[model samples]
Target: MGLLNSLINSFSKTPTSLSERVTTLEIKTVCLGKELPDLEHLILIKDRFPRREKIKISIENETLEEIIQIADIPNFQQYQNFKNKFFDDELEVMITIDKKVEDNKFSIYCFDNFMSDFLKKETSDIMKAFNQLLKLNNYLIFEIFDSSLVPSLLLSTETMVFKKADEENTILESDRLKKIETCKQNSNFYSNSNLELIPEDFHIKTDSNSNLRNVFEKIETLLSIAYLSNSAFLEKSSFKIQISGHRMSNYECDINVQKLKNKEFYEIYKWTYTDGNPADKLIIARNAISLHCKNLDLINIDETVFASIKSNFALYQKENVMQYIDLKNKLAEYIVKLTTTSNDMIYGLFDKFKNNLIAFLTFLLSVYLIKIMSNQSVGSVFTKDVTYLSFLILVASFLFMIIGIAEVYFQKNKIVNGYNELKKNYEDILDKKDIENTFKSDDLLKKSI
Candidate 1:
């Protein structure tokens, strides 16, 4: 009688223990657009639940199979629900699958507390078994959530690539951190589970679907702007003349060509750097386009120049030509002004140093003269009667040296303040206003179209 009671008690406790484990489990899956074996074709080989009780089955299938036991489950209906919800035409879904085990059986349930080492291990094992059973060639991403609904572990068979943070500037560093945080927040699996997952949001699909043409256009625009900004401060000797035009048949004289055979217009001939200064290939390509637009009338020209490059010269339409030129000239003038301001500040610094140097030299000379006058053999004029006068001269030289040092310090502070203001303005012009105006103009054009 005692042994029978003990066995019944153990059996009752098994279901409760299993139920606790199941309620804490959370599963997230990311399929890498790979074909999976039919679920109906899978054959259950074994069932081991909260108690680890394993049962063997004899069945034949195209692939090896196994069954995970969950407590308090009566049928396969719950599992089917999970599979149906995860299926997608685009082969991507971010969801949390929940199951509960109780009373020595398992059934699918709503998500509750998910934080558990045991649950994480179980989820991982299930994913691995599924991969093997389906003979999947691509890796699946898995994440386990804790009781607080926060992910405790993210496991994937594929390597993840992350953009490196810029360490040189505080603003860039902050931007990088924000980007990372945004990526995490908008992540397929981690985002608000209610939001429907889109294939474009997935990293793998995004890489494949990105528009290369648009990307190249943006690169070209940025390169052109960079070239213009750098050339603004270049010396005349370092500026190479880039002439592109056609010789008019009627006049037998070269006239500036505005349009190419392909209906593209000439924007601006880039001021190339002399001495073969390594240039951005994108900028070089822009310059080639400009030349092509200029020399459209020429019978024989290098066709290879247009080989792989897409012409964005059409973007520089006649309507926008004057505006573009005006913007460029304004930027150049701003840079030149900044250069002049910096030069003036440097000269002021040098002048202050020279003045201080003179004052210091005068002090040293006065001290040497006083020493000579005080020497009994060298100067009897500095006898007891005039000894006080010598002391006064020494004190005055010391005062002058102190005053000179103070003046230099004050002048340096003023120069530094001016330079700082100039630097702020320069950065505002180059970094903020220039890019802002470019994009604004582009946006305006787009809207007008």
Candidate 2:
């Protein structure tokens, strides 16, 4: 146990290099025979898929030998039977397939020489396309062969195994205690469960230089997140990781970097035990985002980190941007109110002036009519006598003007005061009490009705 502790400690303190070889890209999808497109449509798929080399479509039908273009197939969909598209015996990879023809699934395999072709930017497009191709959220696993630091064989055993220390076992226990103490010297280093989580977030910084082990560790973290609840899977594990409702840790997942240079690589520790859950949207989304981030080269990131980043994005957005929006909205609301009050005051003044002008003109016409009818001169008619209606018109015009002025004053006092209070409150935060809007004392607020 003491020697084992030493090996683990030595590995932790140093830098290690991981060599990656992209071995195989495996695609799994569930489709009915009819779901498979006709040869005419099928030949077009290669156009959508990646790889510079031409895609070969394998269909066991006598009518369509080799499909080069959709134009040549000529009514293939009308005559061809859907059942023959992926017969259980046809696909070599589906070893344990269902006997029923209706409930069949298949995997498509393709590869090129390890170096010259597979790692280019177009592979990113291919991953995005494959994500759409996946059915029922079943994942397409991308495998990269790696030299693991902890051999896949060791993870299943003795992870958290402990024995009672007695008089006979005092020496071994003391050695364990001392080594444990040394590791714990750095706070947050040791998990209550014996899993040794790395301190920093994983990043594949550049295509030329990046860590592959981080890739595996991240996937392992995701798988643990995805399937920690399945009791059957837990029983298979040798040790228990700390858990609450979802997998929780003292460590945090990083969301900064966007794309990885290499496809996701996980240690064979998972492959040795159980196949992961079939429909993990979390895993599927990560695969697509990694590809997207890679193709665009806008940023480099780990895919799983995106989940944490997105989950908390709404709150972060509200915190930073919403405050500004609220302040601006309050400012806008008050400004609109102030502008409406000024506009209404001007309109009321104009309306009152127009009404008075009409009334004065009508009084003059009536006075002239009465003077002509009674045979009196215009100057005498105005000074001595006028009709009752003409007199009422002059009095009403003056009253209307007074009422309009009063109403405008009433509104100016009400709306402008509200705006002042709002401005004062806002100034508490902005600290800009004495700032001017530059039209001088008629500062909109100080302007008379």
Candidate 3:
């Protein structure tokens, strides 16, 4: 028992090294018949490699022809003992480079001359092999290869085996301890799960860049946020993961955590592109934002970020711009109330004066009818009563005219003056008020859309 314990300790302390170094690429091809053509041309290149290097063949099809063809192929010393393993009939053929390399140092050299030549030949062989392999299933078969061959091999279903660490001491250093420490410090990196109630009065301003930063920072800061109980409140919390550069895109990820722990933590990681570009950076950022909000439910995004993108779309469609107009008009309605109540009162006064002038015109016609119907001679009527009647009519008519003139004059003046007042106020007062219509809100929400 003592010797066994000592041996185990020694092995545990040893640096885990790669078992073998191998480069792998996949070829998907369809050949035209039941019998696959001679793969000799391809095998010759394989033969040129060191004979001691082991190559293994695994077939997906159970047909006798498929087995015969696979068996005819050369096997590496490492794979020689495993030749019978491929005889089990399946519909797929997987030829693996049976060399184990350390997970940390996996490399695929596609740009090399030898690899290029080998691929040229193997590409045809794979096509022919597929043709023979799929003769029974005459569906118009198409093949899709992975973008890179190296990672595919490393993660292949049949070729790779994942072994979880047996002992706690063997576990790789994780962010678990750090996340627990952050939660205990109570920095508000996030809401406490124990406090399930998001304060009802909590109205988070979606307008602050700092808010966005805080959300994203929280995702990175509280690693343990990931391990909480699956509550709806927890799911609704905004967590943000920012993907900044183009060099990191490609992998899709989800949060992983263990159950049964009183305190849980979130571990965030993503697969990014090795080849970096401006577009990739933008895509990464967008994808990260989407995933963060979508999956972990973290971060409050403001309209400014939303509108910056929206305005770009609106440039093509005028009708879509109505939303902006509506918002502005609403704000203008509030501004109108604040700046110009006296102007509205003046308008009301002008309206009343116009109504009185209309009634006075009706009275003039009645007076004229009364004069015509009277028994007085036309000349006398004009001579004796003309002065009084004319004076009275003239006075009344002139009063009505003055009122009309005054109403028009006041209306024009009010409009002009009111406009100037509004302009001056906007520049001097309301524009700086940090009100809804101020440039501050527009500037904040406009960037995102």
Which lDDT values do the candidates have, in the order given?
0.32, 0.35, 0.33
TM-scores of all candidate predictions against the true structure: 0.26, 0.26, 0.20
Tens digit of lDDT per residue, candidate 2, span 210-322?
Answer: 22334433433433332221211111122222322233222122211322223222221122122322223223333344344444431233445344434444454456356
TM-score of 1: 0.26
* Top candidate by lDDT: 2
TM-score for candidate 3, please give it. Answer: 0.20
Q: Model 1 segments beyond 4 Å from truth? A: 1-381, 430-449
lDDT tens per residue, model 1, 301-351: 344544423243334334346665665676556456645654665576577
For candidate 3, the per-residue lDDT at 131 reads 30
Each candidate: RMSD to true structure? 23.1, 23.1, 22.5
Worst 10 residues of 1 by lDDT: 164-173
Question: So what's the TM-score on candidate 2?
Answer: 0.26
Off by over 4 Å in 2: 1-321, 373-376, 383-396, 424-444, 447-449
